[model samples]
Target: MTAITINFNNVVKLNVDQFYQLCRDNPDVKFERNQLGEIIIMPPTGGETGKCNASMIADFVIWNRQTKLAEVFDSSTCFKLPNGSDRSPDVSWIKLERWNVLKPEQREKFPPIAPDFVLELMSSSDSLSETQAKMQEYVNAGVKLGWLIDRKTRRVEIYRQGQPKEILEFPTSLCGEDILPGFVLDLQIIWN
Candidate 1:
């Protein structure tokens, strides 16, 4: 199933706390909020997508463990962006220094800061346009780098702050660039 967006802007606008509660109340449901306060109900990804996501997350975790420069987060972790949107990238990372600045309590709930890097793996149910828009939102929210990997099309859209997006066709691998510092992702596991 695809995601369904419900606009409650006309009736009742949910504040941050209310949105958090709504998510908490529905543990089984995956929800996201746009900058306009519209609720997006996302469906669970297919097995292939889940496996690909796990592989990508494992790579990030291994790199983070070795470098200890950033904190890695899986898809379940959400971030409250500067533009008031709540987003959860498939795999995300924040510089340790930036993460350490948040109070202990702040770390327990949705993080109120943008991540340094984000990776989004597209699923069959996702819309390319919507996903691209989401990636742009991440850039606007101060994300240093972002990757939108489309398995179906075998393409990757790279987003960098203050620069236009770069699209690559069937890249065998991806570098973390300066933001990740020495990290690289092998796309073989994702592609085949």
Candidate 2:
């Protein structure tokens, strides 16, 4: 099933603490809040999507282990963006310096800082337009780089801070460039 959005703006607006509590109460559900305070209830991924997501996260983790320059996060971690939205990317990484700046308490809950890099792996239930809009939101919220990977289409949309998005068709791999030195994501596993 695709995501279902609930608009409570007209009735009640949940603060960060309330939202956190709601998430804590529902441990099995995945939810995201847009800038307008609309709660998006996302369905869990299917087996194939889960496998692909795990593979992608593993690749990032391996690269992070070697570099030690950034902190890598999986899908479960959400961030409070500067634009008043809370989002969780499929795979995200923050520079060590940026991560270190957060207080211990701040790190325990949703981080209030944007990630340096984020990757969204589209699942069967995801809406392409919605995902694209989410990627653009990440860019606007100070994300240095972002990738929206659509497995069905074998396409990758690369988002850079100040440049227009670049679309790649069936690329074998993706370079991290200056943002993540010496890191390259192998797309063969994902494409297959």
Locate the minimum summed-lDDT window of 10 residues in model 2.
55-64
Q: Which structure among the candidates has the greatest lDDT? A: 1
lDDT of 2 by residue, 68-114 (tens): 99999999998999999999999999999999999998999999999
lDDT of each: 0.96, 0.95
Model 1 Cα lDDT, one tens digit per residue, 50-148: 999998999999989999998999999989999999999999999999999999988988999999999999999999999999999999999999999
Model 1's lDDT to the true fold? 0.96
Error of 1 at 118 (Å): 0.5
Report each candidate's C-alpha RMSD, comma-separated, in the order given: 0.5, 0.6
Measured against the true structure, the TM-scores of the candidates, in listed sequence, are: 0.99, 0.99
Query: How many clashing residue pairs are found in candidate 1?
Result: 0
